[model samples]
Target: MKIKVIKRRGFEEPFSIEKLEKSITNALKCAGIGLEEAPKVISKVLEILESRMVKEEVHASEISDTIELVFIQKAIRNPLWLNAAKCYVLYRIYSDAGKVPAKFSKTDLSLSFNALKVLESRYLLRDPKTGRFTETPDDMFKRVAYAIAEAEKRYGASESKVREYARKFYEIMSELKFIPNSPTLMNAGTPLGQLSACFVVPVADDLNGIFEALKITALIQKTGGGVGADFSELRPKGDVIETTGGVSSGPVSFMKIFDMATEVIKEGGKRRGANMGIMHIWHPDIEEFIMSKCGPEEVLKNFNISVAAYDSFMEAVIKDKKWPLVNPRKCPEIKNALGKEVLDIAIKCSEKGVEVKWVNAKHLFDKIVMCAWKTGDPGLVFIDEINRHNPTPKLGKIRSTNPCVTGDTRILTANGWVPIAKLFEEAKRRGVIAGIVEKEREISKLGEEKGYETEILVPYGEKLIPTKAVVWKIGLKNVCRVIFKEGFELKATPEHRVKLKQGPWVKVSELKEGDKVETYGLWIKEATVERVERLGEHMVYDLSVPGYGCYISEGILSHNCGEVPALSWESCNLG
Candidate 1:
């Protein structure tokens, strides 16, 4: 009878001595043993295997165990053999660990075992008394579909239309063609219908504004949303607080408070709380912000930091000129603050009245590059470029993007908060809102108010603009988290641009701490940076507003609906 080996999954295959020899040879190489000794090692292992071959078949583990035993005996003569034994054992463990479980079969929908595990742990609804899963993956999909379809009723959709759309929704979801943000996945069909994933809260220069933003951040995070904000407006460290006759601790100090708050809420929130911090390059605390993540102590792990750079700043760096760091508190009062050239580009890029500090542009740029290279932090966002392409410039310049920079956010449509992705689907499929036909009147009403034809309108400020188009794509890319001093956070692709304090655009990957990005409210404001973190690669989405070139996500003014080229997907994570 042919010698056979029983695999871990209870399957038998013909035992191949050649394959075993190769595995042992690789292990010996890793132990720094010469290849010439591989044959000698193989012979010794074969002797043991032959002794154990009493039956026609044997477990795979038996062969591996015998090899390990032989290597252990050799270790007494040479310690390097011990490494070979460890290597072989680790290889076996890795092979077993990587084995995929059988396909999930509980539901009609096809899903991997890993996917099923995720659903069971986080997505599926649970029984109140027993805390066991109350529904299957199919049931969860149906629940979400039915609940979302029910919303059509509020918008004048008939019973038949609602059911029809629900069926359609179910088909796409069940087939794995379309999936909504995490909040929609977890909270939809449940009482916790707060489904927005990214928000931008304003962090003004005062104590009240900072704390208020923190409060809003906590609330949104509790509902599984991430926040982004610009901290550039806050006075730098040691700035006199005229009201209390005390020195300000600056944005970096306040960022710690936000970080602590996020850490606390992440423990209890429906999902982990995340933040984006944007500080302007001109801020006096720019150095501190850039190095925020580089501290010896692990601080601001919950936040991301970016430096808001400008065209002039980059130009100055290239020209080896001095760049002026202006005081936000005094910039507005300075004559011609937004002029083409400051006092003199060569000497100082500042007006006569504003308080400014000069730094070598190349030096600053080098610091940003070095820090990012070392710690993968303080990404850059070009404020001017983002505004130049702002789809909804009327909405105020986009200061910060959503957590994912993907347009998985809800656009404040005339009808209400509609998923931007859904609108994109409508645009892609039919170029109109025929599926959600009820929104036509609301869009028309909004257009009438804005003095434009209402095809589909997204709010800008007091006005609304017709949505020109919604675009989407598929690819793996780096998504970064940027945290502001007052606890605002946004996640976007590395190259996504955000507004700087002085109204310039810079990339998220190039942002350093103390850079101020735009934040939305009655008007646009700057939030200073706390830190920046690379959250790794993910499949992202984008939404564009075309002429408007921007949209308000949660409360932040985001470029072109999301970060760059449109939207980013920010979903709720279960663990």
Candidate 2:
């Protein structure tokens, strides 16, 4: 056959049809395509090439694309033409792209052919009844594996290396087939791009602020963010209304809007939104707030409700004192009350049990603990603690923590508290200090008082004193000094002046006849000495040292020798 090669300035030289045919034959031979099929595939490609608008400078990429399209549409379905056509097209493209030629010299193509056969077996589908054809989902993976195996076999790649490549190809296929988490699988490659577990919104005092927050919350929830809000800032029920000249519904009434919002939002069009609603203890409608969580006419079952308690209220409970229930609107005075006034009201309430739904502080604490133990709901957060530790303490007091209290930044600016006390409690139980400042303070106090700094180690028991004297003598300096430093003025007791005139010590042998001694702030007559011996580092003197003494041991008297008398320590002066 005659051959013509074309060349143009600034372009790679192109070969004639005869030369292209020989090149295809060589590539097919290298890829192990049978000589019988190679010529037929090359002849068909030559026929298609004759119709192309021959350019002065021919780009191999353009030719490859055209050839691939032709093969896909015509030759791909025929098993006999498939491998040869693939080899010819791949060779032309690789030659143009400067990639390794798709040809084998000495290596056998059996492994590559077998790999392709496995792919075809798994991924080529035929209608069971009609015998029509279809490609299975695994077809793409199988094709990739077949291509890799063919390349490795032709290149004399190591068996281990070829197996490694095969394993990686399988892994890619497996991952493509596996299911992922909802957000990751849905939004990972999508445009909207919101992937989070929860969000918290703040309900402000004004209508614009409230509704705006609600709208944002709805938008977030619509995209699958669980939301919580603090409704405590809303004015109480029946409080003065400037806009409508009528009584305004309290936080509980407004909470219905949130509940309704949750119903409408629909998380990713799948589930209802979850929320937490909280109110402070000083709220005018706090009674309503507590009841809103329970009772037949409850408003928000979707929301977890909590009461924000301050430090003073918690302390009053610890002291078994009364606590006042002050309305934020009507009795705003009690909102920031402290010291004796708050304590007095609390105590009065405790006495009467009717001032404002009086319940024992411990009882309320137990209710909160028990409820959490049962349903894992109604979490508590120390509101004062939250505020004290808030980073932006200057902005405003934190009214509530978020639903989970995973953090506190939201609380400072959000004007709401959702009690995450259970979460905090859980963190504490795990020994993780969620509140760094609080934990530091506790550790500091413990560190300061760790050693021998005034500890009461003696167990409770009867004590005795000996040798009565006039007032103004017994060592009261240390006790008085401690009291004075503690900001307390000590009153003089009748026995404060009693003096230890002489010999507050007694020997084991010298203790005998009509002895009296003082031990543990009490005076007692001493009986006869029973026995004496050495115990470890100290001498054990068994003297009758103290009130109602009967066969007293030396160890007891010797260990307490600071208050023991001389010879008189042994005698029984029981009268």
Candidate 3:
């Protein structure tokens, strides 16, 4: 005869030996006891349950009592069983107590004690007169559900349909299957009604623009939103302010002002204010930005800073090349020398207007890695990689991310790209392939061609090697127009590696007017640079090939991402 176990609430269910075994095994594990003897101990406990089989239903407490009695008997042979018995009893007590809050003990929601405490303090509506919690956990879920579902009325939903949807929403929330963002949980139904968790504010390079962004940031944080801004537009430190007749203090100094404001304003007066500060790699004061929060003292405590590393900078780091830090104000004017056969942009910049500083890429990258290890302030944001997945190409470049990095852009996939604005949309989209991303988590493969099916020509030292496209990507990269004296032109990122006549890889930015680079058509041939100039921004695409880590782009040899060597090596002393 099958026996049923009667719960404390008077609900009866068939006794599950599997559940009993799992519970006893958990108790044993918690007490640091071996599980090898668990099955034997469980069998002894089951011997007692055999007597209760004559009854149609057995009280749940009786099963617990029998388990405790068996554990006590086992304690005579092994003292560790006593600890296991105590753990088993304590588990029962807490599990019972955790079912619901004291006032709503009969409610079906199974919330832990800590969860209830959090709800009472931050979520549960309180009585204005008494300042005591006026709503139970279930009531709190219901209030949020009803308020959100009521919006369906505006969308032509029927009253009965609205209630039904609200019931479903409440079911998901109360069961802990799904929880909305914090702002939605906190102020969705409240008067504040601000449901956004973060906002991106623009900061132009002027007095009015700076203060305007600051004011907007403060107001957003007041209503429970964090703020993020790219400070790359702001001129470098000591740049002349044409109107004020005083030199600008730079982006880092302005970041301090914003950080101070964030320190004073609590988000929604309930959460701490947060901000993300980003500066481009080409920004003249990038080193200063990287070291802003490097010390033991708390500096820019409210802000998280990141260097908007362009693909060129990363490529420079991997190839042990010099990375140029340029003034954004000078970029447009420098492009004016479009047809000039310039020796170097920095040398050309001096003739045009301002001088650019070139730092050893590996050394600078080491400083970034060290600073992140030291204070965890400065992190790298791959600007080129980010712009590649831009869905709205016509709407201009995406400058800043939200404080916690939420955006509805897109990702690279085979055949093209797909907008990642909605999860369901991405799922239904064709040409999306699976690949391993950071931390071994699988995501849509970033590609421009069918990875396994497509092959490309990769330059591998005096030979054009056929390589399969493992992955490919499409994005906006700062393209350098290199006109060869051999009557051909190639465009790619400044740091893109091309083969030199001496059989070494050299960056496009470092290639001089007379530098001879290798080219491929029927065979590898030498092409001397006639003119090297900045071609402004453009839609650029590249493929990731095996072995050589390079591909044939516009007849010139080009390297793929710089991640391979940078991630594998520990030494930064490579010349």
Q: Give the best candidate by TM-score.
A: 1
C-alpha lDDT values of all predictions = 0.63, 0.41, 0.62
**Model 2 stretches astray by more than 4 angstroms:** 1-186, 297-299, 326-376, 384-575
By TM-score, rank the candidates, best first.
Answer: 1, 3, 2
Best by lDDT: 1
lDDT of 1 by residue, 286-319 (tens): 8889888976878888987788777788888899
Tens digits of per-residue lDDT for model 3, 1-575: 37788876677899888889887987787667999978898788777788656766788878988887888788899877776776665454435334322223223226643465466456555545544455566666787888889889866899999999999999898888987776777777788787777666656567766886798789888877877777876788998887979998999899999999998888766677888887766668988888889966678999887876656667778989886666755542221111111114446556666777777989888989999999886877765565565454443233210010011222223222222223223332533221111222122223132221133444433544343333333334457778887776776667667778655677778898888786665244778899888876654433433223455555565554432211110111101
**Candidate 3: regions farther than 4 A off:** 1-109, 126-131, 332-351, 391-575
Q: State the TM-score for model 1.
A: 0.51
Cα lDDT of candidate 2 equals: 0.41
Judged by whole-model lDDT over C-alpha atoms, candidate 3 comes out at 0.62
Q: Mind giving the per-residue lDDT tens digits that candidate 2 earns over 22-115?
A: 7656655754556675456556655665556464444544454444455445545765444554555444333433444335221122223333
